[model samples]
Target chain A: MSTDLSVPVFTNQSEEELGGKWGMVIDQDLCTGCQACVAACSMENNIPFVGETDAAYGRSIQWIRIERFWQGSFPEVKMTPYQPMMCQQCHNAPCEPVCPVFASVHSASEDINLQVYNRCVGTRYCANNCPYQVRVFNWRDYADARVRPELVTLQNQLNPDVTVRRRGVMEKCTFCIQRIRHTEDVAKSEGREIRDGEVVPACAQACPADAIIFGRIDDPNSRVSQAGLASRGYHQLEELNLLPRVTYLKGESNNGSNG
Target chain B: MIKKFFDALNQPLGRVGLLIAALVVLSGAVWGIAQAQKPPEQPIQFPHKLHVGLGIQCLYCHPGALRGPSPGLPTESKCWGCHQQLQRFADPTTPWPTELQKLRDYVQQGKPIQWIPVAQVPDFVHFVHRPHIAAGLNCETCHGDVSKMTVYENPQVINMGWCLNCHRAKTEDNSQNNPTNDPAVSAMLAEKRTKLTDCSTCHY
Candidate 1:
C-alpha cells in the first residue's frame, strides 16, 4: 500500500470499465416530490426520526432526501424537478479511503459501497469526505424507546431485517441490501439467477409514478441498463471520476406547467 | 485529601492494599461476564432430554428453521395436544410433575410460554438458518446434541470468529478435502467462499 495520499491505492480501472453490478436510474421528471420515497426508506431501514429541533439543526437521519432548486427569480421563478438524492454507491468511493477504521468499504461480491456499522467508531471522517453528503451520523440515541418515549409504540413497526442503529454510528443508504440479499438467497435456493425486477428497494417500491428503477446494470438487457443508455441520463458528480452507479435522467422544463 | 491518599500509596503496605483492590475489581468483572454467558431461565423448565429421548425431532417443534430466519417456538396448543393424550395426564391416580403442572397452568390460562433463546447472535448479524440447513448442515453442527442435555444451552459462544472458522474450513481448497478436484465443485466452493466471507453477507 502506498503512503502517498496523492495517488489512489484501491482504484480499479477494470471495475470502472466493467460497470457496477447493481445500479439505479431515477427519472427526475416523474418525481412528484411527495416524499413517499423518504417515508418508505425510513420505515424499511429503521431510520430514527430525530425530532423537530434536531432536524432543524440538519441532524435528520434521512437516507434519501428530495433536493429541488429554484430557477430565475420573482414571477419568473420555477422549481427544478425533484431530485431524490441518496448514496451514489460509487465504484471508487471517496468515503472509503478516509475512514480510520475500515467501516466504510467496498463490497467485492456486490460491487457496492458498504458501511459496516459495528466497525464504525464515530470518527465522522467518512461523512465529511463524502462528496454526495449522503452519510448521516447518530448524534443521540434517537431510536431508543427510553430516550424518546414516543418511539415506544413505533418500535413495533421497525423492520426486523434492518438493524436499529444506536448513537455515534454513521449510516447511509445500503441500496436496500437486505432486500437484495433476501432475493439472492431465494433465487439461489431455487437454483436460478436473480431475475430483473425481483429485487426492489423501498424507494423504488413506494414510488407512485415508478420513477426509480433498480436492477443489474451490468446486464445490457436489464431495465436499469436500458434506462441508463438514454441521452438524458447522467451521473451526479461525473467530473470527480467517482463512477457513481446511480444515473439521473434530466427533466425538461418545456413541459408547459412551469410557465 | 487527594495529597494524603497519594502519600499513603508511597508506603509498601498501601501498595499491597492497592494491588488487592485492583485484583478484586478484575475478578468481579470476570465473574460478571461469566454470569452473563449462562443461559437465562425460562418460564417453564422444558426438559430437552426427555423430549428427544421420546424420538421427537427438533423440526417438529421449531418448523420455521427449515423455511426462514427464525425457528419459532412451538405454540402451547402443540404441547397440550400431546400431553392431553398422555397416559400419565389421563389417569387421575398418577401425580403430575411440578414442571408438567406449570405447563398445564399456562395452557389453562391461555398464556404463551416465554422461552429464552440460548443460542443468539447480535442484532448486527443477520443469521439465516435456511441456507445452512440447505447446505446439508445438521442441527447438531451449530447447535450441540440436545438428546443429552436437560435445559437447552449453547454448545459454545456464538461469535463472529466461530462462524468464520467454519466458513473458512468449508471453503478451503485442499486436495485432501477435495479428492476429486472437480472444476465444477471448485468453482462452486470459490463462489460460496466469496459470498460467505463478505461482510455484507451477514451484516447489512
Candidate 2:
C-alpha cells in the first residue's frame, strides 16, 4: 500500500528462520515428466483448465509443467524433459520490481512469493517480467460448473485454503501455504516446534519417484538446504542473479546414449 | 441545513413522508431476518441427525475429509449397507420412507443424489479441512454447532477479513515455537522482522 505503487521485495532473517526460505530441490535425473505433478498440483490448488486449444497456444494455466528440450531431431532425436518450472521466489526478483500494482510481493515470514489476486488488475507486467514463464493467466472461467460439467462433483474437492481463481486473473504456485499454516497450527497446539520436512506441497507428496524435496533452506542442516547447496544444484537463469528458491539437480547420463 | 428543512415542510406533506419512511425501514429489517433464516431447498433432504446420531461420524460419510480437498458424501451402496432390509417394512408411520426410494433409484441407475452444500468459502481462500483437523482445531471453531440443527445453515460468513483476522492474531503469540527458545534462536529472531506478507504463501 505504498504511494509509489511498486511491489516491495523483502527478505527478513527472522522470518527466514521461522518460516524459512522454503526451497524445492527437484532431481531431474529421477523425473520422467509423466505430468503427474502437473495433475496433482491442479487438483490440490483448484487450478482451472484452459482446454486443449488454449493449451496449444501456450495459454494453459499449469502451475508446474515439464519443460522439454530437444537435443536432436527425428529418429536421431535426443529429447529430454529438463524440469518442472515455477516461480523461483527470487531474492532480487525482476517480476517484483516491475509490477506497478504490487500484486506480486514477498514477505519476511513467507519464503514463497505471493500474488494478491484482489489487488491484481490483470496488467500481466509481472508475467512479462518473469523469466521462468510460470505465471498463468485465466483467460476464461473454465473451472466452473458451466464450462466443465465433469468437474462439477470434483470441484468441491478443491483446497479451501487456496482460492479458486476466476477468469482474467493470474495465478501460480505458492508452495501450498495453506498446508504450511495448518502444520504450524498443529505444531503450536501440541506445544512443539514445527520440525523440518513436516510440511510438503501436494506435488512433492504425490511425486511417484519422490524427486521433489521441500524444506527450509535457511537451516543448513535441513535436507532442502543441503540439496540446494549441492554442486550439481543450479537455478534457471542463475546468471541473471534471480537467486530462486527452486533448485534443480543435473539429469543423469548413461552408456545408452554414447554406446 | 435550514434550506433543506424548509424544502421538506414546503411540500406540506412532511408528516406523511416520515410515516412512509418508517414503514419501509421496519419491513426491510423483517425481510432481512427472514432471508437469513431461510435454508435453500435441496434435491435431497440428507438426514444429518439420523446418520450422525447413529454413531456414524462425519468422517464416515465424508471419507475423503482427511486426505482430499473435498469430503465425499455417502453413496447409495453405503446407505444400502443398512437400508436394504429396512425397505421391506410395511409400517405406515415411518417419517421418511421415500429416503429408501431415492436410494433404490440411485443404486439401480447409478444416478447421483444432488445434495446441497451448506458451507461455502470465497474463491480466493486456500483452506483445507485435513490440516485444520490434524491441527486439533475443533469442528465448532468456525463451523458453529451442527449437531443441534436439523437443517444446515450458513453459520459463518467466511470472508477474507475473517480469515486474515485469525492469521493476524496467530502471529502475536509464539506459543507454537519450542518451549525453550535457544539463545541463538532468540538472537536471530531479535535481529530481523519476520516477513508475514509474502504473496506466494496464500496465492499458490
Best by lDDT: 1
lDDT of each: 0.89, 0.72
**Consecutive 10-residue window with the lowest summed lDDT within model 2 chain B:** B189-198
* Per-residue accuracy of model 2 over A43-107 as CA lDDT, tens digit each: 88888777789899889888898887766668787766457887777866777767778778765
Error of 1 at B149 (Å): 0.9
The candidates' DockQ values read: 0.77, 0.34
- Candidate 1's DockQ: 0.77
Which is the leading candidate under DockQ? 1
In the range B1-204, model 1's lDDT, one tens digit per residue, is 999999999899999999999999999999999999888988888899999999999999999899888998988888998998898678888899999898889899999988888888888889998899998999999889999888889998889999999998888777855779988888888887887889999998
User: Model 1 chain B: which ten-residue window has the lowest total lDDT?
Assistant: B170-179
Tens digit of per-residue lDDT, candidate 1, span A1-259:
1455677466456644857899999988789899999999999999999999999999999999999888778999977788899999998799998999999999988989999999999999999999999999999988798999988999898899988898999999999999999998899889999999999999999999899999999999999999988877778878888889999987455232221
